[model samples]
Each structure stands twice: as C-alpha cells, then as structure tokens.
Target: DVKVTQSSRYLVKRTGEKVFLECVQDMDHENMFWYRQDPGLGLRLIYFSYDVKMKEKGDIPEGYSVSREKKERFSLILESASTNQTSMYLCASLTVRTGRGTEAFFGQGTRLTVV
Candidate 1:
C-alpha cells in the first residue's frame, strides 16, 4: 500500500517559534498536500505540490509555506507558530492520474499544540 509518513505524531510549539513538519511518501505520487484540521472547521488546505521543486498555496496559506525539493519528500514550514495555529496537521498524497474516489493516502497526522 502507498504510505505517507509524517515526522512527528505530536508537536508542542510556543507562540512565535519557527516550525517544520516533514512528510515522505513511499509511492511516487505526483500530488502532495498539507492540511490543517480544526475542530468543527474540517480540513483546510495549507499547500500542495504537484511536482518536485513546485509548490502552490491553498485555502489557508497565511503564516505557512511549503517545500518540495525531491519527488518523495515535502515539508511544511510555519514562519511563527501561534496559538491559533494549533490543530491537527495532515499530510496526504495521490497519483497524478487519478480515478474517481481515488482517496488520498494520509500520514498518521501531527497534532501540533501552539502554546
């Protein structure tokens, strides 16, 4: 099975601290995404990369950025972690040529608590 691995299952960050969350995929999928899941708000996209060295901002890109230097690795960066930024961070990937309901493979998720 295709697997996405996240660096951390839980992260505690204080306000105004830089943070990096790593993700790696075993399958050579072309699409990767980072999303923040908040209570009642659901998952909101933070960024996505369709290819190596390429990145795109998603719905909630403010205070966050992403990097994809290699085909199998993607990273999410928080310039300054804030309390409001506290949420469950999810990393996911899918094939470039997708079929209907081809669900994305997800990491275990990083539960970040910005104090």
Candidate 2:
C-alpha cells in the first residue's frame, strides 16, 4: 500500500512566522501533492511535485511553496503564516502512468492553526 507520512499531526504558527510541513511516501510513485482542506472549500491544492527538484504550483499556491529533494520526500513551506492559512493540510501521491484514479493516499493530516 502507498503510505504518505506527514511530519506533524497538528501545528500552531504565529502570524508572519514561517512554517514547514514535511511529507514522505513509501511507494515509488512519481507524483506528490499538498493541499489544504477547508470546511466548505473541500480540498484545494497548494503545490505538487512530479520529480525531485521539480515543483508545480496548484490552485492555491499563494503564500506557499514546496521542495522535493528526494523521490520519496516532499516539503511544504509557508512563507508567512496567517489566520486565513489555518486549515487541515493533507499530503497525497499518485503514479501518473497508472490510468487508475489511484485515489490519492492521504496523510493523517496536519491541522495548522495560525494565531
């Protein structure tokens, strides 16, 4: 099974503080993604990496960035935390070669509360 592990289950960041959330996948999948889940907004992508050193901005990439220095590891960086950025952050991965939706495996999730 594909396992995505997040660095933290929860985090609290003060306004303007920089925050980092890490994710690692056991599977050799090529695609990794980061998203913030909100009540009515569902899951909005923040960033994704298809290969080491390659990163792509997702729908909601503002105030965020990412790093993929290793095939199995990905990181999300919040340049400046704000109350609006507080949300449940989830990490996922998939194999683009697979036609199957593969239902992106998710991390336990990091509930980030920016105060």
In model 2, what are the clashing residue pairs, if there are any? none
* C-alpha TM-score for every candidate: 0.94, 0.93
Candidate 2 ranges with C-alpha deviation above 4 Å: 96-101
Q: What is the lDDT of residue 43 in candidate 1?
A: 91
Displacement of residue 18 (Cα, Å) in model 1 is 0.5
Give the candidate number with the greatest TM-score: 1
lDDT of 2 by residue, 14-95 (tens): 9999999999999887899999999999999999998999999999999999999999999999998889999999999986
**Clashing residue pairs in candidate 1 (N, C-alpha, C atoms within 3 angstroms):** none
lDDT of 2 at 8: 97
> How well does candidate 2 match the true structure in TM-score terms?
0.93
